[model samples]
Target chain A: MNRVSAIDIRNVTKAYGPTLVLDDISLKAEANEFIAFLGPSGCGKSTLLRMIAGLETLDAGEIHIGGRRIDEREPGARGVAMVFQHYALYPHMTIRDNMGFGLKNIRMNKAEIDRRVAEAARILEIEPFLDKKPGQLSGGQKQRVAIGRAIVKNPDIFLFDEPLSNLDAALRMRTRLELAQLRRRLNATMILVTHDQVEAMTLADRIVVMHDKKIQQVGAPMDIYARPANRFVASFVGSPPMNFLPVSVSEGANGAVATLGDGSKVTTRVKGLTDSASWELGLRPEHVRVSDQGLAAKVEFVERLGERTLVYARLGDGTALTAEDEGLSRVKMGDTIYLKVDGDAAHLFDADGKGYHTPEVG
Target chain B: MMSPKARREFGNFLFVAPYLCVFLWLLIWPLISGMGLSLFKADLFGGASFVGFENYSRLLQDPVFLQAVGNTFYFVALTVPALAIIPLFLALMLNRATRTAAFFRGVFFSSSVLSVTIVTLIWRMVLMSDGGFVANIIGFFGFDPIPFLSDPNLVMISMSIITVWWCLGLPMMLYLSALQQVPQDIYEAAALDNTPWWKQLTHITLPAISRTVVLVVIMQCVLQFQLFGQPQLITQGGPNGASRPIVLFIFEVGFRRWDIGYAAAASQILFAIILMVTLAQYFVASRREGRGR
Candidate 1:
């Protein structure tokens, strides 16, 4: 088995003239850990990955792979391999040559290079197409070849820059599973940069959520999903997103008593309140249930997905929020319904988008 | 009673009719007539009589014609490699996405807009043996002013220098466009693969633009094989006809000496050589492409 190496990044900053791409950021990855830098478009996640790979120059800070500073080293000398978003396979060369290209460049003997290439091809299930050029393969096969190219290098760190984004939905799912299996088999420290939260949440050992050129939150996938660091991550990481309603807060015994926009009072379990005059009440769709008494809302639209139904509702004061209900429930547009608010599962965000989470229910 | 699809196809043919007419009249008819004219003893007066293969037979023994062919081949040897290599280097230099690269690209491609006569005229002034720019610069180093156009030995070299300078812009542009079409990520991937810049150029850049290289080579060959303007305008095949190319010899024979049939025969020979070379290049390029796949 190959020994996995840890990665350390310190105070990295990158800017393009006047525009700041990556602010001062620091991260550390344990050996054999899979880290995903997840963000929206233009959020510097890919930039950070490229910086770690030594493909992009950093305006400031240092990166260390296996406790040695590699910020000044060339990308190949940095003991890292990168899988590009488009695969970037050499179209003129066969899969075998493409996989062995880096090894050959480093003066590896023909026999060793061929052995490594053959092993990578077998691992990637691309042995059948080793003699074929990239243009002759399907999209998934080409992506496998690209991954094989990175694998044959046997670098200390593997950097994946949205490697599965080009595949179709079905292929992406299958490839995502294969990548997870590969990570387990290789046990190498890998960093993936992607905008898809599901891929980040499902594949990464830890997920670093970034937004607007700064790190928003870094934690395990469920930790981030259950207890988001802020309003942006809360909304960004979840499908259908969390719902927010403007409210005024008051100190209560259990946590904080908040008044919704429609004058409905709800007691939230979130603590550590500094007595804010105005705050936003955040709730996930799964936490809001249809009940007899709570907040009164008019159902504006209904989305009946086969497994679940989503109810888009508006409060008396025109605050909109979506709630999940039984799929076979006969909820229609313009129907008035009362949604029970689970205060223990709610979240409170101050004016600055800082999120305060509630304690877990027993 | 044409079908709608047939009518649409006929309509498309109508769009091409004008060009086809001009092509047949100007190019096709002239080529066929030139071949027929090669079989006759004709001149400017047009009292032509058939002379079966005499012009071709006499051309085989003509020493001056053979020398012109040899000189033309020498010029081809000099200019073809220079045209292929120098422009590619310049294009690689200008391929970077920066203000300086754009400015240099514009500067390099600017010469291609000038007519051949104007280019030769500009070079004549710079290459004049006495009080010329080049001679004066050489004289600054305490060396004698070398005859550029008048000397039999230096005339072909001078003409080659002029032609390469005047015609480099088009191929450079071709390479620049081809270089732009190469994705930036490929080079980044190669860089991460530990490939040096020179290896990247040879292994990645060259292979990616192999088809373009073949195109530029064949175009340069065809253009260089018909070398006329530089030698005719600057050297005028001077100093005992040492710099004379085949095209200039044909001009001398047909217009000056008025041996129309002989001139036509020589032109046919030149055309045949160019055709064979171009077809051979295409053959090799396609075969290599097949092997690459």
Candidate 2:
């Protein structure tokens, strides 16, 4: 934790055959920081994590850990431990042996290895199953052993590749919370790769959103959710992602006025873009409310959950839109409701799907 | 479920009818007949007389039969270890050969497909005295040409070599299959843990394949004890009967001498030895398994 940078990746690139999987990726992880690589499937997040683990070779850049170059080092020599997605526990060994295997290989004394293994088992709450083999343990217990194996290594950095993807939904939630707690307890630099947005949002100190093998934005989860760098980030970070609609703008006496497809004009303050022909408007479903003074719409369908409901409606030009409402509010399938748009919290995207500054606040 | 009292035992008999029929006709009946025949003295088509344990008594006193036992035991001792160890060595190499593993596995296993007679014929010529590959190679080293098939001192070794060459492939295939069952993740974990290759082999690979090794050793012992083809074709149990074996001697007694009772006794002895050795192997393997866990 005393090191300036626990992991410093510089201009790293990787290719698998003809496919360019990772391109010019660079990031510096601070000591004891918890970073999550969040992306959709096949976005090269796991590949980048593997590169840092020394499991995969870098085609073009340098990776340094604890201020030492480790590009050519083997996985064992890199001073990093990895927990694989499959929970790759040795089938033949008991839980005790599995946790102590790495220490034994490193030539730790018998008593020391026993102590470290015992300590890890206690931390993971797997002491009861120490004598049982991995095959005998349940899924959650096996995953705990996998974590214990890495924890016993006492490495500077821990690399996880979608480690929770195999668990059931409930177990995944509980295990993720435990992992967050474990990270805090150990104060070790940890990097996690996962496609689940909720996991990333809940677990990461700073989330790095990746798309098409490039990092789009890096920030706290709520910050990225509130202010995404691009359309992809805005779409990927939310559960029901931000909505987009094509709109036209013109200069009026007060400022710039935007007209929805339904001819409902809303005035907004924005800089530049004086010559653009058209723009796309983005807003989260939670940001917009069903108020009496906004654009009018007919609700096509209402999906009622226990806590919230999603009203799928259409604008005047038949453009589909959705809004969130309390589940207790009884709206039938065909009920018409007054829809409202909060112009300040809304976003404006240029032709290339990139979000920029919006002047007025809601 | 049916009541235990109403579910008659006839149902069990009906379920096992086919197996019982085949077992009696193929195995039990012949075994009983053989044992019965060994108790009486008879020629092929002549009337029999009770001889009690006379044939067995004579068998114990016969030097030739004793020699055959010694020779067969020597063959098993030489060939069983080779069969067990060499195939496993070759299998390990093939399993670890990342690039050409399939090709080398096929090559090593190719010999198992050949019939034993064909294999013996091939090696007989290869080990012949004058122009054989083995003799010529020895001559190239400025050493005397080994009388592989003719010399009493060398015939057992030569026959064992042929046995090993012919029988190695199957055990190698078994060990290879066992090796494939071992998870690659274990080895990767070991590598990441900085376990050396030799240590990994000793602690991981060896233990993982122990069952297969035990199976290979038992199978090799049984097969080698029944050694016949190489001695019959190459040396014809010659050079002071050094290459003679128990199965060949029984064949000589039953078919050549036409003394069915004595041959049956010899056959019983051979069967007894095979059974004892196989049981011993099972005991040893089960003991190891118990200890390993």
Candidate 3:
């Protein structure tokens, strides 16, 4: 965050011999923005990040930084620093030497290098361990050292390749908070690649959802969460994912009506609906609630989380879905319950997976 | 009753007691008696008397003993560095596992398994003065038939070359494994830092494997110190004792001349030198390791 620079990736495509990894991919990240690329494994997110960092050569495309072309430049010359997934700290060097190594390789002034390293150590609060090697530090400390190595460079942009994936859950949460605080302080143009959706939702100013080697959606965190661009985006961005049901759409009294798999009809507010087309009704678990009178379902299981209880049930037509009940409710397996869905929060998808959403209620 | 701590200590000692027993009886007893024998003048024919440091003093002026010491050091200087450096380059070239790498690795390592007798026999055919393979090559180049093993100047070089060829496998294997231990990500990280290849080798690779270098030096030093069979079978310590190492001198003095006391004195000196060199290497390596490199 030391100095801000926008990144412009233009139609970057990559392939490994016969298999294509990314196809016609392009993205733009504004200066001083914390953008995350979230996807499942092998979704081309990490590969695209590596391409931007100059670790991988692009088969076809160009990248520009701060309005200057950097795709042809060497990695170090492009003013970008990356923290690798494994924290790639040099085991033979102490923390000070490890942080100062790249500077020394670039032939920077010794005094200036030392000053930068000391300042980075101060910022990371790792001054006490400057003389310690990587073997002596805990996992969290080594991760901070890896970040400090990037920070000492003071590059125009910082790239993180799943930097938190190796940590245990508690440490990962703490490190995520620290990273959020760091971003607030530095204002650096940072691009992070991760498969964890919660990390993307909590830390990113914007999330770029990727699937099957293509960018599915790019927007603010909540915007993408509430209104995904497609089926994959809807499923990938939320925990336990959005549920889907086969539905037949037709003109109703007020608008298009979706006859669900279990023969229940829900009115939709969709415009320019394609008549006589295959459709899918997507419902979030929260939108489906246990009520006295609604579509009947047999409770397959109940998960009693601290804040809420989730009921997994199957409809009369044997279509499985999840509904939320009161935390203190006595719902268990092998019980029948009625589920009422809020159609206003539901989504409709066509055969091609394009989404149509209900307008937000004022 | 013994204290509990003493009992536990006795149990730990008993775990290794068998090995210690063999070591003490076979190694320690001979070492102490040999040092004691060095203080006397004795032969295998039962002629014995107290000579004190007389034999040790005689050794300082003995020309053959001095030449053997010098020649042994010369062989060490030749063999140790060659065995270290050549194998390093070879290991680097063979680091990637491929069909061709496998073929060449087998070819290079096969020489190490040959017995010294067979090795000398093979090399002697190529180095024998008149009708050898190398002498024939030299003759084809309009040069006189050069004696490889018979000449004082060439015999040490010939022996060093043969020993290095025969001992190349272990160091190369160690270096290959060390190189593999350095993950590919480290090099990728270095490349992103714009580190040139030579700088990466010097600053990263060399420092990472410094312990292996020290180990190769120490191991080769100890191995090369016991150089007898090659010189004994090939040159017979000929051409004015040019290639006679310390071990050969000990064998001749102890067995042929039956001057056991004099041979024991020389053996003690050789043992002391090896111990000092090994201790010096260990001291330096441990100090560097303490600095976390």
Candidate 4:
């Protein structure tokens, strides 16, 4: 047990011939911080994690662990341990051996290796299955063993590549909680790569959202939820993501006024926009209040979850928007309803997809 | 009178009938007949006579037959390890090779396509004691040409080397396919765990492909036990019968000396030895597999 080290990545770029997989990505993780790389599939978040682990070669960049340059070092020399998406536990080795294998290779004494493996197994609650091979364990048990393997290495940083993606929903949730607890217990620097935003939001101290080979935004989960950096982050980070409606802006006395696609105007607190610039009003489903007097929309479908109902509606100009209503609301399909936009909570995106936030009220 | 289900079952039987006929006629019948033949005295031009266990007992005391058995065991010891190990190493090297992997695989495998006779002929020319390719190279290096095929001491070694080269391809391909089947992420995980390359080979690669390794070892044992073609075509088991193999002895006793009964007896003993060895190998391999799981 040594002091956990920070990870610094600078100007890393990777490509497969003509197609760039990761483009000049730069990020840093403080010691003992848990960071999540959150994105859609093929977003190069996984590739960036692999580069930090030294599994994928960087075409151009430098990565430092504890402030030592590791770009040219062998993967074995890099003080990191990875838990693969598929577990990747050796099929032939028992759980004990799988956890101790890397230690054995490093020529650690037998007693020390055993002690570390036992501690890891106890931490992961996998002590009962230490003698069994990976094939005999449940999917969740195997994942725990995969994590235990990383733990026994006592690496400065732990890298997880969608470690819970294979489990069923219930098991995924349980394992995710266990992972969060493990992070607290170990207090090591950890990087998690996942496409599931909920996993990122729940497990990470900070979430780095990526798309199309570049980082879109990086912030605390609540910060990302409240003020997404761009249209892509807004759309990608939330479930049933933010809805967009084309609008035209004009300078108003208080802030700005946006004319919706249906030619209705709403006063918005969002500022620093040119009057002639085309903007889109970004509103989350929950932010659009189903009031009696607002923009006119006809409901197309209703998804009634236990607590809330999602009303999918189309505006007068055929622009689709979803609004969250009370579960007991009698808004049936084809019923006309008015969606009251909370201008303070809504976001404004220009044609280039850059988001403009409202100034905080004193 | 047949029901539809019964008729369908009979139709399924018909599908395998052709293969079954060939199998019984060519393989099973000969195997049974050979076992029966081992217990009696039969000559080429005389009536067969029952001589229970006589041929078997005589072979036990026959020095030439004993020598051939020892020679075959020696060849197996020499070639089987080489066949099992060299190809695996080559496969590991070729596994990581890109762009030229297919070409190298084809080149290495090309020698196996040649008939045993053709392979032996080529090696015989290369190994000739005078004015041969190997001899000339040694001579150029200021050393006298060593007899590869003629000397009694060097003949078996030369034959083992030739057989190993001729049959290296199949086992190499087996190892290659097994290596490919190992998931790539496991290696990546190992690398990230700081396991070095060689340790990764022993701890991960070899254990993952242990089943295939056992198969190649068992196959090489069976193949090298029957060593005949290399020694026969090149040295003709010459220079004091040093390179004579059990199968070659069987051929000589049955065909040249016209002692079919003795040859059959020897063949039965060789078969029993191979069966025992293969079964022992399987038992060890399966036991290891059980412990691993």
Candidate 5:
């Protein structure tokens, strides 16, 4: 088996006139790997996906798939199939025709096209709706037909550009589960671009967190969640964003200790330079435990969400911090409590918003 | 509060009164009058003779009425296809144009807003034998100027061209509007399917706009059956009456010769021909719609 790479996109940049959309993005996926490009809207995530699909031309670098240069090829010759955000199903054709459309276009034998379409319909569990036109199908069923259209092509790489965004929430969840199951079954190289963190986390083998036309971090979902490379990712990935606090760094005999704006100091094993000594302390809501040994803050409001509660409060310096607690816990508004910032699990960013590597305390 | 029954009745009357007024005076009255007059003979000065079936009997021996009927069919055959196919082609070309779509759409549809007199006058000047723009352009190519309007064989062609040009813009605008109704996602889906442009035009674009095509074809055929002004103004019924359409013949018999009874019978024949053709077109359209469903 040729295991070099399914798709290798090198320094691909796209621009529309004076607007630079994707600024020097380079990405790759090994054979049979599933990757997700996760970012906020207008972050060039979809642009990179379209570049790999040959739907959009790259302005700067080149693209290769299955060891063949494909920057100059049309989308049909790129050995790739894409499922668009709108599903883009042909309204005039039935599901069967939609599935068999690409094969028919390439002039494949009638029997072969039928066979492939049938196989795809079976795999997507849409055989019963094969003869029904796309207008008759539900939103989820239309999306399945769109995927079935891609599947029958038997492409080496599958690119999905937010295909599940159009569905309802419950449908989105179910379809995402099915897509994850499909990736496991097919083992083809699949690249999905989504702004939904939950989708990227649940479906991707590796999630590439992108911001401002550059990749911030690329790793397994949990790994990136636990250890974001910079301040932008730390705030971007969580449900309630990570809290950032200005801190003063002082070099002591033990090492560097960061003093928070709330007058609470925590000794850290991280070292700071003499030139630029201030840092921004980052802490996730889930990591901060409500206890008696940490910083003190007054609870401003409490949001009870059945299984969990969010305590929104202000620190001594009037900085708001949200603490997630169990749903059954009864914490009244305006109640003062010791809100701990787990310094061991905390992160620090330097002046330029780049994370300063902190050696853990032994 | 007004009752629901009264409200519904008022709304129904409101919706239908506009059509009913025009339909009664313009269509129903004329139809009933023509049927009643077909049995009797009448002149332009309100002088009438109670002749039972005499005008209808005389219609059987009238060669001009037969030739008018035949010529009406010929004009329909010529102008209908020209009207339908040329406008459809223009619409397709306008649809394919990305840069100047609005400009061309405006230029094309502007013709439909012009008066019929202006249209006929313009074509009359353009198709003039010696000094017309068309003849001059042909003469510059070292070719002798052929008589477009005067020649018997060419007069019908010239009239058909003028009819096509004058009526072409409405259907082009209509087809353009219908083409706009087709969602662009369908075309993108076809592109993603790797269907070639020609196949997509055949399967996707054709089926999508087939309803408009059928409607335009039937309407154009009915319009062409009433052809008069272009042939009358440009050819004046031509050398040896080669371009004498049924409407022109009806005018000549009714007004020029004071033979209203003969013209009425001839017009009834033309109406019967139009009715048959229209019914045939509707039947075909309904059958296609059934098959499509």
Candidate 6:
């Protein structure tokens, strides 16, 4: 894994006829970095990747890879390879030919092309089925062939557009592990576009969370999880989603003090002086506790997952929130439960869904 | 007294009985009678005698019949490729033409609906020996009018071209349908692979639509091999029977000369050729399916 080339995208914009699909988007992926664009459908994630691949023309902005501008170059001239979402392997060619097609097109010596293709097949463990056409192979095998095609080219950047979304779950996990291995082995920049947060969280060095035609946030996985930039990221990045509850804030010993709906007070470690504006507390289910000395809430339902129990509760003001107890806890539906939030672990978001977190310690 | 299942089966048989009767009368019966007729030295209006293989033996040495067979092969060779390829190019060109594509597809295909007489009549005006449109155009280029239909060598080529133009619509439409089914990402992938346009076509476009190509090629083979109406109406199998195809020779022998036995034998040969083409298509298609599995 020796090659390292950074990709920088600046002020990129795109539109489809009259609709603005992407607006003023920009990001930089450093050398050997695996970055993911995480968003829901129609977030222009795939479109942005395609624009870099030269499939979709950029309405405005410049893209540079390894410090050379590539936005206007023909797709073939760009030193990048893309694996399409559907694994668009040529139906007519055998797996070997499919992997070696680009080399043959360049008129590379036959021996060299064969060696590269063989090396790729061996790496991907697809050597046994090299002679079979795509139609003769299963979904997973074809997916490997598609990856092998990209690997044989040895591009400086590899772009994947939801490459695993089509596979069944077990195969998807295995393929995902292989992709992580590929990143370490290639030592090249990789940009993956997917709506699946788990894929983004597990494999990426940094995640670019996109929503509503704009980037929401970009940071390391756990950083974003622990200190999400906004309510959207807080809610989008986690399963069983983060819960938001209205609270009144004021000056406190270490940070802001937030008053719960049932008139219960919790002191946060955030240092502030004024109680000026309305705020909401953002709490992941794990950060909320069920304590007898805290706010009294009635549990509406309980999910007894084997690892943990999720309690959906409502406060006296009828504001719904989710809290957790031990997996073996005896919390029942319709029970009156006292809930306490960890102020240091909670977040403060303004009316506009902008969030603020307590300062981190060294 | 019948079981319900048996009664339902009876109803199903009754529903198909009409088509079965017509099939036997129009198709199956004619084939059997034709085979029986080929074994006899028969006339259209007179008594017949059993000739057994006599007519078949004579056909092997008949110069006109042999010429017809040779001429039919030449026509198929010329027309089948033109029909398969010209339509392909037209479809490919129209595929990207977008807004005007549908309009042009309709215009090109309009010729296919016209009766063969109307089509030949239009071509005859353009290709006639004297004062023809094509001849006048050639004269404008400071050359004498060429005898397109009168020359033995030129007539077959002329007829082949006319057939291609007249029949271009259907195969082009088929190719267009097949082309639309190909995912656009495939081509985008090729473009990123640095493949030239020609290589893309050869490697991707052609192979992807290969089943359709096989279909079009076999269809044109069957259609052009029965070359009758054009030469009959335009050239009248003239220029010393140079443009005489097998069906045309059969017509001349059976209907014009009252040699039913010889005509039936020639017809049998044609039927045999068509069967082979159809069988070839079957084998190719099944082998392709087998490869898929």
Point to the candidate with the largest lDDT: 1
> Which pairs clash (backbone N, Cα, C closer than 3 Å) in model 4?
none
Residues A208-248, candidate 6: write the lDDT tens digits. 99988899999999998988988999999998899888888
Error of 4 at A210 (Å): 0.9
TM-scores of all predicted structures? 0.98, 0.88, 0.89, 0.95, 0.90, 0.92
- Which ranges in model 2 have alpha carbons more than 4 Å from their true place? A1-5, A248-279, A290-302, A313-318, A357-362, B1-20, B96-99, B290-293
Q: Write candidate 4's Cα lDDT for B1-293 as tens digits.
A: 99999999999999999999999999989888899999989977865889999999999999999999989899999999999999999899899757698889988888889999899889988899888889999999999989998888889999988888899999999999999999999988778767777878888999989999999999999988998888888777787889999999999999999999889999999999999999999999999887665
Per-residue alpha-carbon lDDT of candidate 4 for residues A1-362, written as tens digits (9 for 90 to 100): 55779999999999988999999999988999999999999999998988888888999989999999988888878888889999999887889998998888889999999999999888889999999899999999999999999998888999999999999999999999989988988989999999999999999999999999999999999889888989999999787899988988888886778898779987888878754357988899998878899989999999989688999999999999999999788899989999898887878889889887787557
lDDT of every predicted structure (CA atoms) = 0.91, 0.84, 0.89, 0.90, 0.82, 0.90
List pairs with backbone clashes in candidate 2: none
Give the better candidate number (1 or 5) by TM-score: 1
Q: In model 3, how large is the Cα lDDT of residue A360? A: 65
Q: List candidate 5 segments past 4 Å from native.
A: A1-5, A251-256, A266-278, A357-362, B11-23, B49-61, B96-101, B140-142, B258-279
* lDDT tens digits, residue span A221-261, model 5: 98788778888888899888888888888775655678888
The number of the candidate with the highest DockQ is 1
The segments of candidate 4 whose C-alpha lies over 4 angstroms from its true place after superposition are A275-277, B1-12, B44-46
- CAPRI docking class of candidate 2: acceptable
What's model 3's lDDT at B16? 99
Two-chain complex of model 2, DockQ on C-alpha atoms against the true structure: 0.43
TM-score of the candidate numbered 4? 0.95
Q: Write the per-residue lDDT of candidate 3 for residues B1-293, one digit (tens) a residue.
A: 98999999999999999999999999999999999888888999978788999888998899999999999999999999999999988988998869999888888889989999999999998888778888889889998988778789988999999899889999998888888888777777787777888888887887778889889989999999888999999988877899999999999999999999999999998999889888998998899887654
* Residue B249 shift from truth in candidate 6, angstroms: 2.6
Taking the tens digit of each residue's C-alpha lDDT, what string does model 5 give over B113-137? 8887899888877888779888899
